[model samples]
Target: MQRGKPLPQKEVAQRMEVSERWYRNLESNAGAPLTPEALIRLSTALALGPDERLALYRHVHANTKLGEPEPDGPEEARSALTHLLATHERYPAYIVDHAWNMLDCTDPMADWFPWVREPEANLLRWALTAPEAREQLTDWPRHAALYLAQLRFALVSSRDNRQLGALLDEVLADPECRRLWDEETKVVAYRQGHRFRLRLPHVSAREITVTSQVLLPAHRQELRYVLLLPESDPAPLPNRGERDPAQCRS
Candidate 1:
């Protein structure tokens, strides 16, 4: 479909570089499974984002790989990810699931962004709706827009995810968030190589610049590790137990 209107089957077949009959059979769910190449072509023809592309792969996987292992439960995933977070003790690190729900964080992350310790902490919700976010994140508009863009990207593949749908509804209630959601069309799913200034009241009065890098566990692609690495050129701040910041930027 192009926007809200449905593209003709012939047009879709043409875009996929496939015969109209073949596309119709695929659409009717009455043909052999698509090859990886065909799937890629279909995804491209539909203009799917990363999440949607993954969704397409999973759909094929479900039909073919009945012996695949089940996903790790929340508690199991949290325990494993705790060790992962500890490994990055020098940086601000945290784990989030597909819905951007905070599962765990390094002590340094909690110190710098205590909101992660909140009940049922969700990254997109706080970033988009919380008043504290504006105070802590410099260039709030850009940051909020990025968060919203990620959510919009997720929406493509997470249409059936109740948590994601609820989170979207809650954030869109805010006037500013609603405006951003309506106006932002970009689809950025990760924060790789994104540097932003942050103010941590418990850390230092001065704003610190940090580049956010997102990583995925090899086994659990649904979980993401968001690590905030302080630009190394600046003099780092002193650590004071769990109350101190992890890194500093001048």
Candidate 2:
């Protein structure tokens, strides 16, 4: 918990433009729940990283009273998220809502996976049901299992969400997807720095490896900015007898 500096509670409260007592109450979890804007300001004041920020939101949301209504899903991609996808034009980048539905994507991303332009496009559904996905992804089964696991995780958190329930039903309609969903018990909350391989003959004759980096917008945490950063060709492995010095005991 390396907060930026050892500032006093009063200083931290001043940075967030709140009263010292209110800030202290927030620290003790005795005050009213902070709004999203206030939470963002608090995170900034504390210099929380992406993981910590998400954890903070989850903790607060989990503690929300029974009568409190959950935030509605955004109808369209926020401008900030749209701009983020646009700016990352060189690599494949896209925005997905909490339900894993594709909201917007870059031209390169659309060119690579054209399904994003389809009406009500969903990344999980496409990855699980589309035949092309098997050909495009180097390790289809592993990725498919991962997508199903992530969907399972979402379903638990958003049990009342009609769209997510519908998405689950649609994917389960596929025999293979249903099998994977039932068999894969693993659950994934996020894909912060997941690395996977893609076979894009249109881009290159050989397979390409890209690491997925997830970014959460300050205002719209529900929307995830997924950027696929391409990795350079890996170095050749050494001969079997040539032991690496790093692996040897001192």
Best by lDDT: 1
Error of 2 at 164 (Å): 0.7
* Regions of candidate 1 where Cα sits further than 4 Å from its true position: 1-11, 20-35, 46-74, 233-250
Q: Looking at model 2, how many pairs of residues clash? A: 0
- Global lDDT of each candidate: 0.76, 0.74
Clash counts per candidate, in order, are 0, 0
Question: TM-score for every candidate vs. truth?
Answer: 0.74, 0.64
Candidate 2 positional error at 98, Å: 1.5
Candidate 1 structure quality by residue, lDDT tens digits, 1-250: 1345567889889999889999999989988469999999988988877755765676566435345675666567657777777788877888888988887787777777877777788888888888989988999999998888777666654556788889989998999988987775666657788989987756775688899888876656678878898875344457745434432210
Model 1's lDDT to the true fold?
A: 0.76
* Poorest 10 consecutive residues by lDDT, candidate 1: 241-250
Query: What is the TM-score of candidate 2?
Result: 0.64
